[model samples]
Target: MTPQSIQKTWWKEAVVYQIYPASFLDSNGDGLGDIPGIISKVPYIKSLGVDAIWLSPIFASPQKDMGYDVADYRSIHAPYGTVADVQTLIDRLHANNIRILMDLVVNHTSDQHAWFKESRSSKSSPKRDWYIWRDPKYDALGNRKEPNNWKSIFGGSAWAFDEGTGQYYLALFLPSQPDLNWESAAMRQATHDDMRFWLDRGVDGFRIDSMNLMSKHPDLPDGKIVNPDEPYQSGAEFFASGPKMHDYIREIRTEVLDHYDVMTVGELGFTKDEQSVSEYVAKDRHELNMLFTGDIVDMDFGPNGKYERDDFHPRKIRTITNLWQNAMPKFDGWNTIYLDNHDSGRSLSRYASDAPEHRATAAKMLATYLMTLSGTPFMLAGQEIGMANLGKDYGADSYIDVEGRNYYNEVLETRGGDVGKMDDVLRELQLKSRDHGRLPMQWDNSPNAGFTVASAKPWMTINKDYTEWNVASQLDDPESIMAYWKQMLSLRKEHSDIFVYGSYTALEESVTGRWF
Candidate 1:
């Protein structure tokens, strides 16, 4: 590692535990977890030995994309709690010596938001420029067409036409969640104000969501069709890690972030340019502290996309880690290490088998990589307990995720709409569903897995293996996955240099085939 790159910071040393509040704990018996639930579990969070907590989007939203769609940036969602409740949660978390990292979702806002509603009202609305609304293209005979060939991340045209405004607005996720125009000075200032809102209220930092796609090309251009078999080509090149991404990040840092003693980790979907990624996290650059990259996690994508079949390549994990760690300019850029997140599937089930023969050992191996890596480590809520998938039958009744539903329906369409006959489709979800990580956090072996009241319905299904894989049971067993995670966390504090700054050296393949 380069001498100048040996920079030290509290964030660089933190062991971040990501909490999807809705699945963590339910204190009010609302069938959904809330801020108080998190507050009540601060002791539990601290017990895990993590220094900081990163909460997913809790802002006032319609829950269209499970809180990624924000209606009001300043207010807490009613389902979670009130603004006062958030203040108390922050204070209590601080009292426990744990830092709070709020999810900063500036890429898009809910369609119900005042700005979007106003923008949709008329073509000449003052807030019109706040979103990306463009006129349609014309063919030889002037028949109306979409502005560009760009496709949404959620499997549709990126453009959504509004009859009232006579133009199509861009929404990369859902029609209800319209993409915000980062180019607008007013929009950028408003975003800055929102960041200041939480910073003033004592949020330690932010986990910027969809950070790469915030800035898109000005002309709304078409993307190259990489795969002809796929319905919609990925337009990420036009938006993700865009030309102005670094420029905008610098401006945000100078005008907003530099004023506060805070750290930021951008949710940058896998980028090809190592030089570009380093610029975002370099210590000397006025940009993000670290960033979430999915290259290793998404390595299994087959001919099509997420749902396509591809055998898991274990050795590729080391390849990705070595690339990023060495790719950092002078090793000055920091990387965020994690095997699972709200969007990614569970690590125990994804990277390792949950079978009786390999369950605990597999968890240990993954945790070894997660904690021993030379970067900040992050743990998903139920990962420490060795939580497995809920099951394979992701029929409409059991499925709770929006992206999964989109992929499921698309796959079903290709099979004549008879989903019950498609065993392969169901198996794919069993192995790769993001909901595997979103299952209710197993606190105990209660009927509701101690997540909510037995009678109340959880927002999603709970893993049936909670009987064997839960906090209470694991806490008592020294050999349990949870206990192993705690021990590793303690060790991380002792040998912070090796875990936080040491350069990684990939070992050669062993004849015994023990590790990849």
Candidate 2:
């Protein structure tokens, strides 16, 4: 298809910036980021030349898994500020001509959510079927056991035995985040209502979190053991692209999304097959407008998943990028382009060098790759200033992400709690932990990296090199990564037809260590 023949939409011709609120900036001297902090940076965000911002979850929560575990879908967390603050933020961004996409985490809710509370009140409660609950299995000697051997993406058993309800509830992530039952009409409607609430309040769209994991296998059978050393098995096969997955998404589109002129990007969890992804994003599918691919990020995953190391290879990324670039447009589907986000290590450290002498060049090179891609590019916060990963030398106490903490505990248990035996694991975590990306944004070289007042401690550690790599130092430099990103974004907007909708043709098939 020619570029002129492609469907034209605002999102297709735009770039998105993702903001992880907690680490973005602190407005009050409370050591935590608030909506007002984001409000204060409207001019800074506008200067980037991006079209929209994808704000991470800020709904009321117990914060067990940060704000992803929602206790009140319509309310904002107190640390982040009130609902009134979000309205002001929306108005400010819109006034700057920048759209906002809220993170929609409907696959699960905090165990503290009212629905979950009632669901756990009793086995016969009216809302008992609102969540995934199964009777406990018993051994030959009548020993009580979890319903299945499913392992969580965060680590450990996926099922948590609820003594009050006498059933095991599914929590694919943390125990505090119980998976919602999409089959329940009332529950699905409630989610749709929440979406409408945000849309009514002026949200331009949503980045649906874990969109593909909404439906689980009806039978809820035991998962196959994939790793010998791990106690639980991977249940992704039975849950990821389940029988009713597309049906549920289509229903959502028909019920809520179709009514609004909004952009929807679903986080396609554990799905890599071309056909599976196309079904979710193809124009005629009536589902998500686009989908984020998981293959490129998981390319370096070794036998033990993301924990074990595999030497980085550019050829793998080249193959995956080429496949998607050439394949997605064939089905009238689209992709969301990005290298790293709050969940992964910084791209400069993981994909290129973050060394003192090479960091700026590498960041510009990465920015060029993203801008020239045939999709809507999404830039992570602080990526343009050449932010990097915390190296292997940092101690274990610096790691605070749930996934990283769980891995640390697992390694300690396997190695008999020997601190000496934790060296290799610590090194791996240093390179791979999400905490590296969650560090406070380096606004300036001041104490606390200018993320908060010097007297107030930031929620997470500031990157030690923030003094050298920060926005204040690089914004005006003509050769800086931030400056280059600004130029590239303008270039992309100038020739959106070619850069965003143009066909891709690889010049070399056997290339090594270089992305064409």
Candidate 3:
């Protein structure tokens, strides 16, 4: 079908590669990926024909949530290198004509952050209002209780008790990552200053982490109990799209983002509905240029959440994709097309067959879907080579992600120490854990998959299939998945007006699994 002509912008037509720093490569053989390692792979990234790179957080963090818990937004994480290293990286990538997007995690800060430190000090401290704090409620017997029945995304209570201040502070993800109080004008200003610190250093834009989570319910009310076995409840309804979400988003747009010509893709962490998503990225809204929606990724989630899986229906893919592709363009809101990233399991293993005979074919189909789609496409590092999830045989002990570990312990406790139940959860973890995506990138069939020196132990395990799946073997093979991806990218660029600006129409709107 002929594509309707639309306004052209570099961001709208770009193919972005997301790099999870710790897993990409190790420069000093210190078993961790650093800026120098990324710099070393510049030519390889360029070879992919991508126009931009979205780097996951490199900010100073305590490593509690794998760099999501920012300890100092202005400083670089020590293991990843220093501010000077980041500057050099920006220069190198820009010299190659590739724009860079830094991860912005402002929904919360590491409990160890200087601002959080002051906020937790004395109750009368000037920065006390910088974080969400509420006095404890008491029962008839005078026992203190949490402020609300909110469950953390990682499991357990969302509110963490602080002994120093005799109050509880909100930590929606992990206890070490305390939610920042966006209600405070001073806190908002500080966030803007931190953003400028990076934009001034030449970052092209930001991949805002949990951007929708910036504004939370003002009342801090109790959530309805969804699981009788667990005391806390899902707090998404109240916190996802708070009353002031759009107001705060527009404030950032005018005060910070609008000042620079940069790409802004907000992560709608909890806001999944089409209406809520359109409000943040609609051209008329004066907000973000695009957003990363979780609808496609979360389609298989069961009532019990990510760890519990529902039957995978092929129809959901068609329905979900069509819904976004058909609706967003009407409102002038753009979409981010991706199947997997630093969080979910690999696309090949989750959405397509990963068996030896069909892996290659499934991967090519995924690439075709991503490139031929109606919006910007994001390719995760190592995805080009068909990285599959570490199989269930790796065992529970191999899981390193904090969220998976928390869920493991929570499930164990709730089931009264049923080892079998824990084992079942482990099976699910093998398929859903973020750690699978964090496995070291497979560069070649060498010690440590050429990710680091032979003697240095990697921060995470290299996938066992690396010997056969590394890039060197496929780089020269014309029929390889990586090669096919390169072809698709070239085709997309050659027909930019059709692929990027094209209006989408589902050819199989009523197609179901039975039809296959």
Steric collisions counted per model: 0, 0, 0
| TM-score of every model versus the real structure | 0.96, 0.98, 0.97
Model 3, position 187: C-alpha lDDT score = 95
Worst 10 contiguous positions by lDDT, candidate 1 = 390-399
lDDT of 1 by residue, 1-516 (tens): 324548688998999999998899999888999999999999989998999999998999999888999999998899899989989988998898889999998899999899899988998888999999999878999888788877778787788889987899999889888999888999899899989999999999999998988888887788898867764667877888877888889999999989988899998874756877777887788689988877766766666678777868777776787788777636478888888888877767777788878999989888988998888888888888888775654455577688888878877898898967677767777777778778899999888889999989888888777776788888889988889999999998888877777777666788897763
Candidates ranked by TM-score, best first?
2, 3, 1
What stretches of model 3 exceed 4 Å from their correct place? 1-5, 509-516
Off by over 4 Å in 2: 509-516
lDDT of candidate 3 over 224-254, digit per residue (tens): 8777867899988888878888988899889
Candidate 2 has what TM-score?
Answer: 0.98
Q: By TM-score, how accurate is candidate 1?
A: 0.96
